[model samples]
Target: MVCVANTTGRAVRMPRPGGPGGRLLLAGHTGEDPAPEGPDGTVAIAPHSCSWWAI
Candidate 1:
């Protein structure tokens, strides 16, 4: 899971989880791209949640 602490008083936008195709890391397909956290897509307001897996 990814934890983001925004000390700055501003709303932050993050990329949609898993990017396009919703790719995820697999045991055998380790070479396959495990979608990463990036600065691009949606916005998660406090009290809500943004989720990701770190592989």
Candidate 2:
């Protein structure tokens, strides 16, 4: 899951309930390409921004 903060433009990494090595499933973004890679190979977004996702 990606959490964004609108004002700070920072991304919040939420703790996984299952502990370490948890998996986050991301769906495709319509009208846009896949998320760009980040430091941890996960997509990064600004804090409090609008969330676009799929189940």
Candidate 3:
């Protein structure tokens, strides 16, 4: 799993192991923890809590 942020005006691409069939999960400023199950281990990126980004 990979994570990318476009805070800047640049385009970024994350590589996946299983190619096109791979699944990507994006989590925003939510305070919930992600489930720990997937075909491979799940990948979590920028897992910020709602309170953290409020500031």
Candidate 4:
């Protein structure tokens, strides 16, 4: 697998739980998944530390 070296910060917004006026925003590396979905989000293996949260 090929990985792009990125240092700039980025954010991805997705529909949050519930209905209107709800949204989920997460910041991290942007990559693709070549496998099926699991119980959690896409699995990512990074050389550095990472985290995920919901607000």
Candidate 5:
């Protein structure tokens, strides 16, 4: 799990595999595209939580 801070500096849990998706969510709705994924393919975030994993 990756620990990230928001605009308010609140640390939140995120997935290392799907970091891009999480990063976008933390962007405060900035309409920015997420980071590129590695060769492993983009990760998917699970509902009810910010956690994610490779499918």
Candidate 6:
């Protein structure tokens, strides 16, 4: 599992989750899952918020 936090004010998008480049799951605080990855192969994160996914 992974948790990604966007500290900046602007929203962000990233590649779909998996593989070696991800942080391991935290002990708690799995934020809500965003909408599914877009066809362009990315997930959206709201500004100054967090999201999580299984690696």
| lDDT per residue (tens digit) for residues 11-49 in model 2 | 544333133443434332322223455455455444545
In order of lDDT, best first, we have: 6, 2, 1, 3, 5, 4
C-alpha TM-score for every candidate: 0.30, 0.29, 0.25, 0.20, 0.22, 0.62
lDDT tens readout by residue for model 1, 13-55: 5544444544332211122222343555443423232233342
In candidate 3, the residue pairs with backbone N, CA or C atoms under 3 Å apart (3 or more residues apart, or in different chains) clash, namely none
Off by over 4 Å in 2: 1-9, 13-35
RMSD of 2: 6.3
Candidates in order have lDDT scores of 0.37, 0.40, 0.36, 0.30, 0.35, 0.61
The residue-level lDDT of candidate 5 at 44 comes to 29
- Model 6's alpha-carbon lDDT is 0.61
Could you say which candidate leads in lDDT?
Answer: 6
Clashing residue pairs found in predicted model 2: 4-47, 4-48, 5-47, 5-48, 6-47, 6-48, 10-47
Q: Per-residue lDDT of 10-53 in model 3, one digit per residue for the tens?
A: 32233332454554354444434333334554433333321111
Query: How high a TM-score does candidate 6 get?
Result: 0.62
Candidate 3 Cα misplacement greater than 4 A, ranges: 9-18, 30-55
User: Tens-digit lDDT track for model 6 on 1-55?
Assistant: 6677877777678886684344334322335345556788776666667766567
Clashes of each: 2, 7, 0, 0, 0, 0
Residue 2's C-alpha lDDT in candidate 1? 45
> What is the per-residue lDDT of model 5 for residues 1-55, given as tens digits with 9 covering 90 to 100?
3422234333333344444443333322333333444455553232223322232
Error of 6 at 14 (Å): 0.6
Query: Which window of 10 residues has the lowest lDDT sum in candidate 5?
Result: 46-55
Task: Indicate the worst ten consecutive residues by lDDT in candidate 6.
Answer: 21-30
Q: TM-score-based ranking, best first?
A: 6, 1, 2, 3, 5, 4
Cα-based lDDT at residue 52, candidate 1: 38
